[model samples]
Target: MSSKALEQFLDENIEDLKSRGLYNEIDIVEGANGPTIQIGGRELINLSSNNYLGLATNNTLKQVANEAVASHGVGAGAVRTINGTLDLHKELERKIAAFKGTEAAISYQSGFNCNMAAISAVMDRNDAILSDELNHASIIDGCRLSKAKIIRVNHSDMDDLRKKAKEAVESGQYNKVMVITDGVFSMDGDIAKLPEIVEIAEEFDLITYVDDAHGSGVLGNGAGTVKHFGLQDKVDFQIGTLSKAIGVVGGYVAGKKNLIDWLKVASRPFLFSTAVTPADAAASAKAIDMLMESNELVQLLWENADYLKAGLKDKGFDIGNSETPITPVIIGDEQLTQKFSKRLFESGVYAKSIVFPTVPRGTGRVRNMPTAAHTKEMLDQAIATYEKIGKEMGMI
Candidate 1:
């Protein structure tokens, strides 16, 4: 029989979440996660995917993925430290390094793994990490794993960061100090103040790390946030994901040559975990090549985002300040947010509600992602659906 105590714990917590409207129910996409998706035999104008450039369904990427599978079989077969490092992996890393304007780079199985591996590799118990309170969950876990003195810095508050940085260094309580933040916060869609962050890091001699998971392929002509700010050489570690804009599965750290060398030797995930599939590596490289070749997709993405934002605002719906394409339709109440999302789905839109504890309790929202693949007609329909739902619910 199952352990009664463990079963009780699971049952109680789940029930509490469900009653509070804090539990998230996931929806399955029937086919390609492109501009639109099919669920429950209905097509939805998808506004909840991280596939910013829509490269996930690109014909060229699909072709490359198939070719890689035919040439290299499926899996990488071993951890990167062993025999798993294929020629495709090398080519992908080389492409990433060049794309990010870094001296070298190293790839991991996912963006989460990149943080889990890289953070603990360079930092330890005696060090301290000043992390933005609003950083992704992966970054939080990675910093925790390092056993560092985790100092919470206010979200994009330069003064708070500087004060914390000063205290951390002057106290002489740690061997080394690092300041970490997301390049673009996914929840509210605001860009981080990187120039100020870099300035403070320089003053304190703190190591800098930016997880640009949401910013890549959507900024800096598709290079990333570091390049967007022209601080490519100033940042110590630039973290990115292949699954999002690159439209594949993997993550990487691009930095100085020595840092990449150290991570390749020291990062536990690279040493213990099998590399991403050969197809993933090849397809990712091909996507990067496409981004470097053209700015068409990036421009299209912004245009769609602007149109959606304007439509929502005109309907009197509150879309919080978003400097990037990741838009949040702030609904204020958890139940209301979920209801709003449900109404959207029924109207053939597929945006999802984000509630506590992913975001603060009272700031629940339905996050919208406008992709490059969406045509003007698709966006217009989505906007009209939003307006209808807002009027029905008295939210506008």
Candidate 2:
């Protein structure tokens, strides 16, 4: 293509994004994403990270990573199926399988890649996938890549799921049927009705896939959503991320040994992309070990979430129906929501606005992620900032 044509295309896309107020201007963080982060030389109370158990900066994990780096160097050098399957990678997979109560597990470069790999590996154009409407974008992409007929069921609406699943199976047009959902919807912080989903899947013989990216470190006393609901054996795929609660980097799918074996040979990312670093793998193993050792961090995280949610609710902010630590202070208009976030940042709070297409338009809001590392005083400060900005912007 000509340079002018390419430039025109880029300009038009940028203009479209600007027109929709969905263009995200990157903000550089000068320090680690802790309870307080330094951005633009200003310290802000950070509430937009997925570090639920606060392990991202934990000293123990840091030490583990350092040790692994010293021993194995930084990069894996090749793909896992190539010469990249380090002992650290195997160890991390073993640890993850144990943590998730699965026979085996397979790691990928990212949680997003896990979805991209697993979904397409199992389903295809001859299959049909019943996905929750509010599932993560990665899941949507995965389904699309699978070439499967995508059926979007209402979020947590079992009736719609059941109807769709039954119709798809009864038609006999599909060779396989799968149901995919986010264990905890990141946008709403609502837990998936896994028990109901499992029951439905069993009745219809539908394959179950749960992307527990948000629930892995925050739920099941850190065992994850499958264990939380006692559906470990029932769920076919338990997808999780090391970058979230684990405070490292990478993603994995925990399931039957045969499923993992198939993925090792079939998943495109595993076959074509390089493996995760030894340091990240080692640190993630250590993080899982910590979560299994005690509930102190998980409990503390819940307490912090409760405290922040209660304070926001008391202040008359429409803190949406969040059963987990992920909370959203709902503000309708996109521009107003962005302004609200900007004002919060100015006041030393780091909550970010969620707008289309990360979320539906007109449901724009600031999403808060309270971690175990946050003190009550810190939450109080955030609450005070919210109150001030909320009233000033007429959001409350």
Candidate 3:
């Protein structure tokens, strides 16, 4: 039998969450998350994946990944500090630094791990972090782990950030002040104002951290937001994910040589955790090379985004103010949002419902991620389904 204390705690807490309609039911996908996915043998238009460039299932990447596995082994045998720092891992880091236009780059097992590793490595109890109000959960957890005093700046409010930065600098209480924000706000798909942010950071001499997880393969001609705004040299730390657009399983921090050097030794996860697998590292490197080779995929992505956004707006659905390819159909009520998503799945679209904790309570939305792999026909069908279900449910 399960431990009585743990069983009772889980039973009571789970019951409360279920009653409050806050319990999340996980869905199982049978296969690869591509433009279309098979759920229980039913193929549906998949708009829920972060496979932005569709490189996750690209043939070229698969070829290289298979080759890497053949040459090396399936796994990196031990922790990076011990023996897992394979040649593929070092090459990936070099490619990442070149891609980000930074002096050096260090890789981690995952983007979440990168945050937890990088943040705590540079920050401690006496330091402070000025984070965006809507920064990702990983960023929040990373800051918490650092034991730094976290100050939430208003989301994209330049004035508020300025005020807080000024206050933090003048107070003279904290050892160091770091302003961190997502390069692209994932939920709203809004681009971070890096130019204005850099100006503020420069005025106060605060360390700048930009988590470019969403922006890596979407913005700045697929370089990132800092490059998009021509602030790469100014921003101190730029973080990116291999999973999102790179189509692999890792994350990296690109910065000055010294910072990357420090993180290599000081970051807990990098030192203790095993490095990414040979196949994963090789695939990520190939993806980066392709991104740098041409803007063909990026162009296709934006064009597809425009087509979907226009179709949704024409059908009288609110797609929200999104500067990137992430299209969100705002559905205010949580119950209605869930119902809407269920109906979409039934109608053969796989857009997921994002409610509170992900977004503000009343700002629930069904986010559609249109990839370069999606055909115009698929997007049109998705839009038509939205219109049909929306009108049927009186949501339009």
How do the residues 235-330 of candidate 2 rate in per-residue lDDT, one tens digit apiece?
Answer: 999999999999999999999999999999999999999999999999999999999899899999999999999999999999889999999999
Candidate 3 lDDT over residue span 1-396, tens digit each: 889999999999999866655566788888888999999789999999999899999999999999999999899999998989999999999999999999999999999998999999999999999999999999999999999999999999999999999999999999999999999989989999899999999999999999999999989899989899988899999999999988888999999999999998899999988899999999999999999998888899999999999999998999889999999999888878888999999999999989887889788899999999999999989999999999999877
List, residue by residue over 194-300, the lDDT tens digit for candidate 1.
Answer: 99999999999999999999999999998989999999999999999999999998999999999999999999999999999999999999999989889899999
Q: Superposing all C-alpha atoms, what RMSD in Å does each candidate have to the true structure?
A: 0.7, 1.1, 1.0
Which regions of candidate 2 fall more than 4 Å away from where they truly are? none
Query: What TM-score does prediction 2 earn?
Result: 0.98
Per-model TM values vs. the true structure: 0.99, 0.98, 0.98
Better of 1 and 2 by TM-score: 1
**Predicted structure 3, TM vs. truth:** 0.98
Candidate 3 residue runs with Cα over 4 Å from true position: none
What's the CA error at residue 395 for candidate 1, in Å? 0.8
Candidate lDDT (C-alpha), each: 0.95, 0.94, 0.93
* Inter-residue clash pairs, candidate 3: none
Better of 1 and 3 by TM-score: 1
Evaluate model 3: give its lDDT: 0.93
Give the per-residue Cα lDDT of candidate 1 at 83.
97
